[model samples]
Target chain A: MASGRPIQLFRNMTAKIAAIPMILTALVIFVGGTAWTVVYSFTNSKLLPRANFVGLDQYERLWNTNRWIVSIENLLIYGICMLVLSFIIGFVLAALMDQKIRFENTFRTIILYPFALSFIVTGLIWQWLLNPDFGVQNVVRGLGWVSFEFDPLNNSSIVIYGVLIAGLWQGTGLVMVLMLAGLRGIDQEIWKAARVDGIPMWKTYLYIVVPMLRPVFITSIVIIASGIVRVYDLVVAQTAGGPGISSEVPAKYVYDYMFQGQNLGQGFAASTMMLLAVAIVIIPWAYLEFGSRNRG
Target chain B: MANPATISTAVAGADTLPLDGPQGPRPRPRLSRRNIFIYGTMLVVAVYYLLPLYVMIVTSLKGMPEIRLGNIFSPPMEITFEPWVKAWAEACTGLNCDGLSRGFWNSVKITVPSVFLSIAVASVNGYALSNWKFKGADIFFTILIFGAFIPYQVMLYPIVIILREIGLYGSLGGLVIVHVIFGMPIVTLLFRNYFASLPEELFKAARVDGAGFWQIYFQIMLPMSLPIFVVAMIIQVTGIWNDFLFGVVYTKPDTYPMTVQLNNIVNSVQGVKEYNVNMAATILTGLVPLVIYFVSGKLFVRGIAAGAVKG
Candidate 1:
């Protein structure tokens, strides 16, 4: 079974040729690009990228800038609220839909449809819905609650929450679908056994079933969390970091500096921070999933 | 989708709908206090989900005069196709008053080729990894999948530079390549798992019959894998269509994709705000993916579930 030229590069010539794009992308674009951004972030490149070193100056300015600070804080608020609310809403909806209710397809379709639309569309629709003159504020006020003030788009403080509403509206549907998938994956015998033991369905779900769906939960969290980090278009379409940059997110900050501001160094620094944030979330998940699998 | 009810009942083992069992009059299940609670809450949540879509449609149909009287929840007094017409052919972005036609065409150009090229490349890569198994293919595969999670911002400038170096910067072809690059990971993971799941004996049989790598992939793997290809198609079409950041970054303003241009039209500050036109444009931009979502139905779910599990 000895092969001639054991490690010859072109053994399977077409296969090797077919793999060139993936190889180039993995090596040059993804790896090279990320490294380039991190390195350029340390330099004083403005408008055009250059090798002129600046020794943390961009990072210093990014941190000191009010908009950047506000972006982080908006991200935190949007992240935490979106995280907590979407999960709760999603899990609850999944649980309810898990019931032997009628019209499940219709309900599921209606809910999941929003997940199809782009965030830009989501933002614009919500922008219209929240408009002070024609939106929820006017409608509610028209409904006899004349003192209603639900204009989060214009209000600086809760403008993030305004965007959060639209975000949740668009996102929770996917979360529900994912959770529904998880719920459906639960073994039926557990439910039968719980019923035989006289355990209430709620307690059965809370105490027994949720833990079994840990992988699904982890997947949703990672999906939702990564989504939270890259939430730029939604903000752009909805607020454009409006009424004095109150709802600016880190991703938007990165975009604005790099392209709009033409401050390449600053954008690189900001994007590097984004990269760091994603790494924080992804590294542990990768290790937990793959590391133990390798040995086991 | 093979009867949604049956699928749920099979998965959930909860066909306990009282008094309405379709198969032979089974004893009615007890109507517990819990039934009402479960459904009422779901109705509320469903309404919350349906609100924006309902509002968008209703708002888009109403005339600008009614929109000024603007109760978004109300149905239109007189439905008008004028806004749709305006959005599709007459809406303005800066001095470009030619409506969303430019962006729509630009997106069509970007999405079609990007989808085909990305899927073609990824499926082949997946085939090679799963079947051919070169000396270091898995290493590269690992790095490629890992790269998916990195914020595009980190890769954004570098991609620009790379595209520029390759003489594709700010061009439609360059944007197409960017979509292909970004779409590679999930598409590859999808096809790899798919191809690997096939019976190994087929490949062995084909090999003994003198089929080479390309021969097997082209003759065997592809024809058997059409459904997975459709699923991959659904994922890529939706994803690349919805992408804003890459389109905004990689393409010039004149060639911006629909989502980017849609954002510009709705959020552009210079114009006297036209809510009806904005709503019309919003729906027009979303129409492609939304239509796909409705038509593809169950496959859309399968695509996302597959994407979610791997990605």
Candidate 2:
């Protein structure tokens, strides 16, 4: 086991060489780049990232900006609605699929196919479907229900909900798949014992199955939460943050400021907030997961 | 084996519980109430999920005049392939009227190298981490895993600066590098876990035969790791193909990948909206990933599971 110092330095040299890219990406890009952005957020960088320090001014302006406020509001509404609805819908679909039903693969394929498509495609498809003139409203009116109204895209008050519809259509399949896996992992004996004890299926699921699938639920939430924060392309494709910027999200706000609006300071500040939002979701989850494992 | 023991125990546990219903097999109907509820709910949800794809195909096949007068739900009276051709050849994004073909090829150019390079780099890194445990490797690996959760926006500009300084900004090469950088966390995790799960005896045996790092990787590990390589490919192909943000941020107009180009084409405001052409373009942009998904089948789910369930 005793080796010379020079030999130790040269040992596994191929590995160290191969890992250079990972090292650089982890150290320089992920760690260093994040630090650079957080630092630049404090400066009044316009069009270009400069060393000019203006402490907290960018964040103050970011808060005061109506567009940023709207983006944050839309993100919250979209995030909460997406989280709750996706879990409910995903769990329900998964449970139904688990009912020893026929054509389970076919139903699953139909539901999960949308997850294969990009957000852009999902957005465009929904935008056309929600077009008031030729879409759902027109069809209903032609069917003799002339007073029906179902347009959400053009209405500023409900545009974010419109985006939410497309978001759910594209994403809930992933949640369903994850939940289905979790359900399958449960022991069949649990269900049989419940049935023998005169417990209804619903009660058994509520009491026994769901709590056992807690890890899967947490994983689904983490995946969905990160996705909800990065809700950019769908907005850009469907509404283009339209109806007077009412559907703008934080990701879109950052993009417009950095690339289009030429306000790097604001972009950095907004994105820094995005990073913070992800941390708030991730840090505790990571601790509970990895922390408990190490201790046990 | 353990299976029979567990099964017998489970059967005994079920028998110990008090049964309220008849013990023997009761009269069971094919269309029972529970069956009706489950199948009916599943059918309704399936229709809702299928509606958009159905509408896309129907709308893409219709003429503009038909699209204007007809309901989106109604079948097209006249099927026309004109929209498909127009979407592929004549759809414009800014001054370039050459359509989605340009963007499609650009995506290919971007995807192929990005997938190969990232897999090569990550597979080796994973092998090294799992087998050749050097000093500080776990720390870097931990940082890499944590990096996946950091929002990409936080690193966007500094990457731009880095790319600019390295003279790869606004080029396809630059976008490929970006994909590799972001893809590192998940793919490395995939490979690392996979290699770790492989029997340690094989690796140690090769080492006893005086096999070095690269030699053991190429001679022993590579042959055994084909399925995981496919999983990584599936992840990268769909991911790089579906990407919009990186493509938009990293490349110029001529070099913009399909997603960005498709967005510009569909959302452009200069002319009257061509719904048929726009739908066709949308489908075109999505076709690559969709095909990969259908073809891969269960592997697609495995890819998502691998990417999602991080420890």
Candidate 3:
């Protein structure tokens, strides 16, 4: 035991001290805060945290409320469409860019520039662009298509799609960049082998290369899916869940309830639902992604 | 990795064999049908991406009457910078008509300190985790990384409560902390991966010289990890600048960041809509990150790839 000078508690003292914020956040805020929100969702608190248990009242109310139901439905539609379309569009773009095209740098910079702008800007731009009288509709009408109906912001049933246009415009570029990275990561020898075999490029890409890019696909899905889950700001900035709350999303619902309405229990329940939805998507994927990490 | 010269050489090889002799005089048109298709599609998509920006620029430059009259696709018939001037100096948010400059300065205040502090924490934490090997460091790191997935809405109220309890809820400083907390997982993941990917010999050599943890971090790790720090700064500066939810939720009305202020100014329901001013404000709000994006170029791509691949 006397072999050592001393085993002080502060041996890596700087590290332990430096890590206090991360440790506190990981523990107190992330874990503890999420658990607290879940627990408080069961309470009847209004405007402040309280301990009065209210059982499933909040949950039932949340489900029964047309706004909340609409939020979930919109989330589903947006989530599915954004996920599928972004992947397809992104992959196709990446494939095209991978075709040894000229002006690759220019195309990449132009396409990816939107990823730089905030959602607020994207929403505002799209909002003006979609304005019924003076936006794309009016411009097209002036160009002699007076019967054109390109207005999506003003339509309730299709307002989510309106938000979708902005979201896709803002998002797909990042997906393409990620996919391009994936495509570039692939070995060219595979392409050479396919060429030597007289296999068509499309067939080679579909059969051999697509399967090879599974990890990249998974990574893209995770990024896009998470963005879909947190699809509040786009909706807020674009539509403000307008046309009678038609494009309302759960994140917006939770925010509105908690802050504007001061309905804490309702907001908590809605957010708990949001967390649950993310968990549903993330858990299985995380299992496959990280679960494989351990074994690999 | 194939340079232009190599690609042309390969094409020249293919070209000489089939259509003409190896010394054929004429070169085929570079715009083959396939090249046309690829470039055409990319050009269209690029235009689709550039449309909003073009509209923003010209729309902001035109007079309000001209904006109302002219098509968004057309360049301004007569350009004016009045909107830009007004948006910067006199655009009203409630009783304050001092324009987005306040919000701009506020965002600068928030973003600079937050970026520096977040990088500082992440670099140290990453160095410690990679080299020091504390007993339970990885466990906490795992939790923190996974914690990034938790919806910000859930933690919003709790953070408000915490900050309020500490008497910093509505302050800009409070928002800085909020950004750091949210930015931690990605930034840390970034710095950690970069640090971990460094040659093990460097760390070992430093330790062999009796360099303690702080000494090594400040002396060896920080200097060597400059690129990663820039990536982190790129990520945080754009991210914090673009953040609307936290800006709205955490800051007071006047103290709101540019994104929040722009939203209020443009989307305000009271006054008659100033289309040109609104466009100018939107562009101004977007300019910080846009400038950074254009300036940073490939580093921005590397930054995102780092976050994505590692996350």
Candidate 4:
């Protein structure tokens, strides 16, 4: 009995000890990091972080800044475009593949190969292809159709769309993979029944298959949404937020202020805003995911 | 299991003739039509997806004069390795003009240790959390998963400040620590789900044999986790290698990763913008991850599919 008591005590102690590092690391990185960013946002910190606190001045300045406002608007547009377009394209492609067409492995690989390439390279390739002087525009012009104008990368109004095109190219493959998995999970009986019902293939896809893949759709949306928020490298690589800051997004803006512009206060404020934006969208979904998971 | 004709006729309207029906020996609707439609659509999309890559490769191989002539799809009039050589040997990335070789070594230095440390820590943490039932263990796991959703860029400033205060900022050690810290969530998530799916009897049997936590984890759990270990390694390698903002913000110039150099080369606004050289450099920078993907394609799919299945 005495030996059993010591063993139980040791088990209890080990369990507690095992949790310590995880808790400490989480607290340090998440809680402490978030608090530090919030505090820095209120300071007059620049380049190197200074501790002279100036309440809400940076936030006020951020609100007033044209660049920050433009960045916010651009992010909204870009995020929505990327999310919707990639999903539609990915879903269609996956559906087409589900038809059990020939060269299935080859087609799947072709669809997925772009995901293996880094976004940095993907962005550069897109940039070259979108360059008016040497890209598709010139080729079209060479075909004697001189009226062609494919200068989206150069035009301020359309550059964001250009970026979206590149993002969709890289992202759709991932969405297709996810949706394909979902499709594969589906019972073959459903397809067989629908075929027996004499339902058109398009109707079956639209009415039955799409709705049944709700979980996959939700997961894809969440992943892609987070990706849109953190999308900096692609913009930096492709257009450099160029044609006069038309393609600027919040992450890139925060990066610029923190590093290039040497305005840490503004950078932190921008970051705080981004955090708030993400929280607004993610918290509710997170609550649902957790609540459902726990109930299950 | 109904007759094929009945199934087709049921789907088709009663008045509408069957697609394969004989009415005056109507033109046969070939079985190949549906296949043709599906394959043809996929082929078109594949071309669209691969078009830019085709351009990048062709552009990288062409002479500057050919590139300037502006036919991206056509065969290069004159092939040249000059751009590839220049990109590797003489591309300017700021005051340093030694191409990306130095940055490549820096990337290797950062990536190898970062992958090892993160995987080790995550494996331990995952084993403890999934297998050991402890007060606050669930909470800790939750927070770690939550940390994955928090943008790493948002945490960059604070992490830099914290590292500086500890007298480790701008050093290789500091960068490695940062990578480990950021990598914890994904690696832990990967392993925790993996361990959760594993049969508990294995652990119970090990315990009955008088094995302690560390012994069972190191000897048994770690060995069983080879598939996930590969997944984690691939993720860390690709992520750390392709990372630009973190590398630029964290490391000193002497320790800058290859992505930073690639960024500098491709991002130069003042230079005459050598399209061929930039394409070559970008492809070179991505070579490691591409190789990993090609070589470990099957393992990569299995690892990710397993993780996703649990979710």
Model-by-model DockQ, in order: 0.81, 0.78, 0.80, 0.57
The candidate with the higher TM-score, 1 or 3, is 3
lDDT of 2 by residue, A1-296 (tens): 57688898888888899899999999999999999999999999999999999999999999999999999999999999999999999999999999878899899888999999999899999999999998888999999999998889999999999999999999999999999988989998888789879998889999989899999999999999998999999999999999999999999999999999999999999999999999999999999999999999
Top candidate on DockQ is 1
iRMSD for each candidate structure, in the order shown: 1.1, 0.9, 0.9, 2.0
Task: Give the backbone clash total of model 4.
Answer: 1
Tens digits of per-residue lDDT for model 1, A225-267: 9999999999999999898888899999999988889899999
What are the root-mean-square deviations of the candidates from the true structure over C-alphas?
4.8, 3.7, 3.0, 4.6
Can you give the lDDT of residue A13 in candidate 1? 76
Evaluate model 4: give its TM-score: 0.91
Task: Report backbone clashes per prediction.
Answer: 0, 0, 0, 1
The global Cα lDDT (0 to 1) of model 1 is: 0.90
TM-score per candidate, chains pooled: 0.94, 0.95, 0.95, 0.91
Give one digit per residue, the lDDT tens place, for model 1 in B1-311: 23445665574565555544355433345565676777777788778878888899998899988988758999999999999999889988877889999999999999999999999999999999999998889999999999888888889888888789899998999999999999999999999999999999999999999999888998999999999999999999999999999999889888988898888888887968878889999999999999999999999998989989856
Docking class of 4: medium
- Highest lDDT, which number? 2
lDDT score, candidate 3, position B87: 98
Q: Write the per-residue lDDT of candidate 3 for residues A61-101, one digit (tens) a residue.
A: 99999999899999999999999999999999999999877
